[model samples]
Target: MNNHFITLGNLGLCVAASLNAQRLFKDHRAPAAGIFLVVCSAALSVLPATISLDWSSQPAALCADLQWAAEVLSPAMVSFGFLWLSDDHFTAYTLLTGSALLSMLTGWLSRDGLSVMSRCMAMSSLSCSLTVCLFAGNPLGILGSVLLSAPALVGLSGTSPLVSPEAAGGLLKLGLIGAMTVGCWAIRWALEIYVQDLKGWDKSNNILT
Candidate 1:
């Protein structure tokens, strides 16, 4: 089916983004950031499958439980990563712990269905992540966070002329995943250019000296 292919494509993109993150941040300059991005991307890669499981008829209870857990937990990893990149260790750790606990609570409370409280919690998490990305001064991170969170915000708004309600969710998921993939590659390209510029500057300075 077309939907299945689309899901697989999204999954592949997330996985590729994860690998790119690993390579980009492998340097000592941002090892923690790299780790966080890798973890987040990996989680995202499987998210479609998890979401599918959640929607499937007569899916195993265990799989459904795992889906919700992953949904609530993975985005925090990205937030923590961006916060760490900004050199805000205290806030990062505090928020990481808090989000983890909240995610667990959300999972427990919304076993049968995703409740309003759980949706609010997710929105709160995305808002926090977006704020931190803005504060951190990384354009790519900010853009990625925006793309990543836009779906939740739009869903909450409850209406869109561009997309019918029935098809909106799937389209939003694809858009989010695609945006994340593009953002990762863009960040990687920017970092590469920066490093090259630094090396060139260093060479010029050495020559003058």
Candidate 2:
């Protein structure tokens, strides 16, 4: 129950950011600010993944509770990254490589390089989105991760000075398609779970009879 609530909260933040970014892009003409908000929300979404229970030494249960909340709310980014590094699986390596690439891109767009809010925010949103997706554990998490980043990618490419308009537009379109694809997969997974539950119920009824 706690885990589900946390996941929902993370999804909520991403949705709020996406909506704000869209408004800024279309209405306010300040897509940079919108992109920044998305990046912040992404950061929040991953907060659980980075939390430490260091305060547990304080002899207070509050700290333990806080740690629990953090674990529930955030994805396990570090642990997943470690697994990617330690595991010999090709899939793990691919995710890790992708995450590293995104981090490099984010670093390249630091304040000193981009020197503009729009560009920096765009880079951040892209980086965070990828990281979120990399750390997702399940289909619902995957949907949230992809959807959160998809809009940010479009917004980043369209507004950031670093990207050529033509290239950025193409990337934006691709990201949108990817997001939709992931969403469909999530729905399919959900339906499968429901069907399995029905099957279980039927088997139980037959045994009881």
Candidate 3:
């Protein structure tokens, strides 16, 4: 039971990594290949979990039929992940775009020690931003997303990285993360305030039980 949750979380991370890769680089090839791998791995990992979900019942029936359905549907679900990763570009769009972005901004990283710290903070923000996007409405995910905001605020105040566009783009990424923090809080608040009353609502405590 615990393994299922862990595997599901792994699937989310892989899918999110694939999506973030495409977002960062705009390259379809790496993300497409990654999606294929992720889908295969996800099924190999999650099929067993689905069977375990049946244990919530009196006597779990054999999951042969469900497993077969999962097999048939897994390819399409994997394709959705692929599409989510690609953003629909045919060529190496993400890679090219991300490369261009980094190239256009490389000269501006601060040589100073204080500025280096700022850069580190910005990097942390970027990581948290993606975590927020990956987790969507989850409170823990939203907390990760909130962490991004602090770094963004720090980066904006501490760095002067505008001589080149590449560096500027990096700074912009940090700023985007700050923006996402607000979005994450909004979603979290919405879920807490309005969604809890829904009929099917229950805490995640039972997910692993």
Ordering by lDDT: 1, 2, 3
Q: Is candidate 2 or candidate 3 better by TM-score?
A: 2
In Å, residue 187's CA in model 1 sits off its true spot by 6.3
- Against the reference, the lDDT scores of all candidates come to 0.52, 0.39, 0.36
Clashes of each: 0, 1, 10
Most lDDT-accurate candidate = 1
- How many pairs in model 3 have backbone atoms within 3 A of each other, for residues 3 or more apart or on separate chains, i.e. clashes? 10
Q: Could you tell me the lDDT of residue 52 within candidate 2?
A: 51
RMSD vs true structure, all candidates: 6.9, 16.7, 19.8
Q: What range of 10 consecutive residues in model 3 has the weakest lDDT sum?
A: 67-76
Q: Candidate 3 has what TM-score? A: 0.24
Off by over 4 Å in 2: 1-88, 109-146, 156-209
Write candidate 1's Cα lDDT for 42-130 as tens digits.
45545656665443444444434433443444445555555555567887777677756665664465322344544554566567656
- The superposed Cα distance between candidate 1 and the true structure at residue 114, in angstroms, equals 4.6
Whichever of 2 and 3 has more lDDT, that candidate is: 2
lDDT of 3 by residue, 16-68 (tens): 53454344233333323333433343344445555555453433222322222
Cα misplacement distance, residue 36 of candidate 1 (Å):
8.4
**How big is the positional error of residue 202 in model 1, measured in Å on the Cα after superposition?**
16
